[model samples]
Target: MRLGECRQLRVKDMDVERRQILARDGRGQKDRITLLPEKAVTILR
Candidate 1:
């Protein structure tokens, strides 16, 4: 995801169980799902 998308991220956009980060509005102004690292999940939590 882009910096803008990360800044706009919300709790609802996180799928911890799935280990994915949902970018509701990405680089092309489109939605995408990116991998969420285990280490990052702990930080995000």
Candidate 2:
């Protein structure tokens, strides 16, 4: 996702506390939460 989009994501929309990324698809028709790897999360932080 783009930085702008990421910024638009709210804390409630995130599953970070659960080690996941809740994202909407390009068409905005689908939503899902995907697991994030520990290393990637550390780097992003």
Per-model tally of clashing residue pairs: 0, 0
Q: Taking the tens digit of each residue's C-alpha lDDT, what string does model 1 give over 1-45?
A: 689989999998889989998988777789999999899989877
lDDT, candidate 1, residue 7?
Answer: 95
* TM-score per candidate: 0.81, 0.48
* Candidate 2 lDDT, 1-45, residue by residue in tens: 545446556666655457787766533556666677788667767
Q: Each candidate: what lDDT?
A: 0.88, 0.63
Question: For residue 23, what is the lDDT in candidate 1?
Answer: 87
The 10-residue segment of model 1 with minimum total lDDT is 21-30
lDDT of 1 at 30: 91
Pairs of residues clashing in candidate 2: none
- Candidate 1: give the clashing pairs: none
